[model samples]
Target chain A: MVGGGQLARMTHEAGIPLGIRFKLLSDTPQDSAAQVVNDVVVGDYRDLDTLREFARGCDVITFDHEHVPTEHLRALEADGIPVRPGPDALVHAHDKGVMRARLDAIGVPCPRHRIVSDPADAVAFAAEAGGFPVILKTVRGGYDGKGVWVVRSEDEAAEPFRAGVPVLAEEKVDFVRELAANVVRSPSGQAVSYPVVESQQVNGVCDTVIAPAPNLPEELAGQAQELALRIAEELGVVGHLAVELFETADGRILVNELAMRPHNSGHWTQDGAMTSQFANHVRAVLDLPLGDPRPRVKWTVMANVLGGDYPDMYQGYLHCMARDPQLKIHMYGKDVKPGRKVGHVNTYGDDLDDVRERARHAADYLRGTITE
Target chain B: MVGGGQLARMTHEAGIPLGIRFKLLSDTPQDSAAQVVNDVVVGDYRDLDTLREFARGCDVITFDHEHVPTEHLRALEADGIPVRPGPDALVHAHDKGVMRARLDAIGVPCPRHRIVSDPADAVAFAAEAGGFPVILKTVRGGYDGKGVWVVRSEDEAAEPFRAGVPVLAEEKVDFVRELAANVVRSPSGQAVSYPVVESQQVNGVCDTVIAPAPNLPEELAGQAQELALRIAEELGVVGHLAVELFETADGRILVNELAMRPHNSGHWTQDGAMTSQFANHVRAVLDLPLGDPRPRVKWTVMANVLGGDYPDMYQGYLHCMARDPQLKIHMYGKDVKPGRKVGHVNTYGDDLDDVRERARHAADYLRGTITE
Candidate 1:
């Protein structure tokens, strides 16, 4: 795997029982995945030579993140290195403009938007989208609300253009809430979809995810799953795909974003599903038969533990375990920086309200330790 | 961990999510835990200097197996390293005579037994404990039916004395079935118990396990759990303790064996319980609060995949996964040797028959590949 972040770390953990060698290509020795994996190459994923060196003796290459230069991936493919979610499919996840254009061509429901070459083009597109308060995003390199802006006027529009990357102007659709449809697809065209989940984001970073999206209309949930499956098939995605969606007040879902690897929305599966997303992602990448994606309980809620210096994480971990005997806490081995995701906690049971509350309390208690 | 076997491998995997560094001490680089852990020291665990080096910089030390020399553990403690299941608590697990004597003093239910000095002593023991066909076991270094024998006569009894180790003689109870009560205890006395499980042996090696032991009398199950918990507390066992028991024809359970780390009987907990034995073992060794040990499903069956050269494990893995998507396969990264345990599969559901069948089919299909 390329990029040694928490996703790679968790995925590697899932693969351990499969008895496979997980060779990680990390940018530094201190990277999250590098802290755990046995055979890790400390090299640059952006440099083609570094990537090629890392690919040696590896059966297939996957990712922890999608920031590797697309052209570098294509080069690896040229050398006959198998890259799941090949460069062509991964490009859709890398560039917002490319993703919107492809979704439009494929007849997928998406917000109104267009690639704007300059601030004036952005203003004109915003006028066509809605009058003001439009969402402007850089076509590439944006995550967790970075490189994204809500432009209320021409002056605000100019700020997005300064990013240098092409700007994609989008109508800020008034939606009831955010939802994510996570699916795993194999190179052999086999696929499995997890239940659609309600995602609550705090300042554009995922805060909590409730599996099966409480009280969601059955028909809409089915449609959402089907649409995400269709997107994976259309994009030729061969690993995990997380489709971010906007659930409008009118009971419809629209494509908002796409992540080509395991996403926070599917974190609940670690303790709640018949097979977790990380396990399925490993299976899918290896072109092995995927496991069941059905939820094992009536409800599962995962809440991110954003860093507050991770003050005495062991103390917080002890408190949570003592308080909630059934809670599943997953901490990434990272130098916890304030405002950055450091870990997550999962709670599941027959009662949705109780599960949600338990998850929230654990995450809050752990995060509160930092400030204390 | 002091030994790099599958128990350590799985325990280390559980520790990753807690963001704790797992350092392994293995006899070779190819040891199961060493193959996966990043900070692995390849050395002989029997060598005091090597063990001292491995224990340096480690906060707490635990075990994958009970074979580490008792004196070496004492030395580590003398050096200020916290040895969970400290030497005093671990000696009973390492020597059968010690275990029998300790249990006798504690009023634990066990078989008629004694330390036989020689074949003459064995004959005398057999005559006193219901005549011939008694069980003779070496006082130490025995596992998986090794160093144990059912001697029907004096000639058969002479074989056990040739090992040059003290022999323990006991009555061979006619049992209805085998069962195990697994529990975890922390340094602070916190403890949790998993449901009793039925264990089946093929050629004296554990072949299958069924959680909650089908058709078990509720009162008997509770008694078994209380017995195991009492054993853990009395012995000051600060990690997992698996009490192997025999259900006699008279409708009573008796202590058969004792294991100080993760045991085959508790493997079903990986996919069947709210908290896995490996996770609890990690938590206990670290003196962290124990998680709930309740079963999440109505039934769960685990079948061991013993090796016959492990013919194309990937093919068997694919077939099993495709056949039963809910099956959880855990393979210890070991070189396949005939009759050696390579991996195991777990299946769980509301139906006991279906769950057992699925688990058996997956394990059989994987095992059949070796012979084919």
Candidate 2:
């Protein structure tokens, strides 16, 4: 795996029981996955030579993030190392412009979007998209709400174009809620989709996810899954593909974005799904048969534990475990940095409200957002 | 962790999500836990200086096995490296004679037995118990039916003493089936117990385990749990204690043996129980609050995959996973050897027969004991 973030850390954990030997290419020894995985090469994923050195003797190459240059990945593939979700597929996740164009060409439902040449072009696209209030995003290298702006005027749109990368102007849909449909596919074409989940975000960063998307029409849930599976097939994705969607106020779903690796929206599956996304990603990258993706309970809620006033989340375990013995708390082994995603807490039971409260309480307590 | 094996491997995996850093003491790099844990000191655990070196920067010392010398544990404690299930408690698990005496004094029901000085003394005790057939065992270091014998004659009785260990003689009680009650306790005295499980052994090696021990009388199950908890307290054990019991033909349960760490009988908890034995064991060792130990389903069946003609179990995943998507397979990273436990499979649902069959089929298929 390239990149030693929490996703790689979790994927490595899932691989342990399967007897998989993990070799990681990380930026530093202190990286989340590097602290746990035995064989770690401290290097740059951006450098082609570093990537080639990392791929030697590895059965396949996968990622914790999609920041690796598309050309670097193609070179690795040419060197005979199997790069899952190969360069062609990964580009759809790495670049917003490419993703919007591909989804549109495939007749997939998506917000009105276009690659803008400059701030003037962005304003023109916004005008074409029905005037003000547009979402402007850098075509490449944006995550966790960074490099993204909600532009209400031409002056506000110039910031994105100034990043010196192609800017994508998209209509900001008035959606009732955000939902994610996570699917995993193998090289042999075996695929499995998890239940569509309702994702709640604060400041464009995910805060909580409710599995099965509460109050959703059953048919709509099935449609979201079919859409994700179709996307995976059309894109030739050979690992986890998280399709972020917008459930409009008018009762319609539109593609919001795509993530070709494990995403925050699927973290709830760690405790709730029969097979976690991390496990399925490992299986997919290895070209092994995928495991079941059914929810294990009636409801499961996951709330992100963002770093806050508390520097160490370990102190929260005492009260949290004592209060909710059934709660599953997963920490990223990263030092606490305020507002950073340090971990997540999962709660599940028959009652959705109770599960949600339990998850939220634990997450809040860990984040020091609540004391009691 | 002081030993490198599947137990250690699973424990390390459990600690991963908790962001717990693990340093292992192993005999070789190829050991199961050593392959995954980043910091592993290759040295003999029996050597006091090597152990002292390993314990230098550790938070606490724990084990994957009980072979670590009791005195060495005491020395580590003297060095201020807290050894969970401290030396005093570990001695009970290390030596059967001490365990029997302790249990008898505590009024815990166990088989009638005593230490025999010689073959004549064994025969005398056999005659005293109105039986020629009796069980003879080495007072210490017996596991998986090793160092134990069912002796029907004086010649057979003499074999155990020749090994130069004190022999413990006991009446061979005819039992209906084997069961195990697992419990975990923290140093602060917090304790949790998993549902008692029915264990099936072939050739004295665990073959299958059914969680909640189907058909067990409710009160009797509670009594077994209470007994196990009482034992953990009595011995001052600070980690997992698996009390092996015999459900006799007369409808009474008797203590058979005890293990101080994660045992085979509790393996079902990995997929069945809300808090796995491995996770709980880690929590207990770290002196953290214990998590819930409740069954997540109606029943879960676990079947061991012993090494047979199949050398690599990887080939079995496609067939097993395709046939039963819900099957949870956990494989130890070990080279296959005849009759060696290489992995296990867990299947769970509302149907007992279906669950058991699925687990058994996957395990057998993995072992190459069955095809199609």
lDDT tens readout by residue for model 2, B1-372: 999999999999999889888999999999988889888899999899999999999999999999998999989999999999899999999999999999999999998899999999999989987787999999888888898999999988989999899999988989999999999999999999999999999998999999989999998899999999999999999989999999999889999999999999999999999999999999999999998999999999999999989888898898988898888989989999999898898899999999999998999999998988
- Give the per-residue lDDT of model 1 (tens digit) for A95-164: 9898999999999999999888887887798789868888999989999999889888888788888767
**Candidate 1 docking quality: incorrect, acceptable, medium or high:** high
Worst 10 residues of 1 chain A by lDDT: A363-372
Worst 10 residues of 2 chain B by lDDT: B124-133
**In model 2, which runs have C-alpha deviations exceeding 4 angstroms?**
none
Give the lDDT of residue B360 in candidate 1.
85
Candidate 1 stretches with Cα past 4 Å from truth are A369-372, B369-372
Compute DockQ for each candidate against the true complex. 0.86, 0.83
TM-score of each: 0.98, 0.99
Q: Rate the local accuracy (lDDT) of all candidates.
A: 0.92, 0.93
lDDT of 2: 0.93
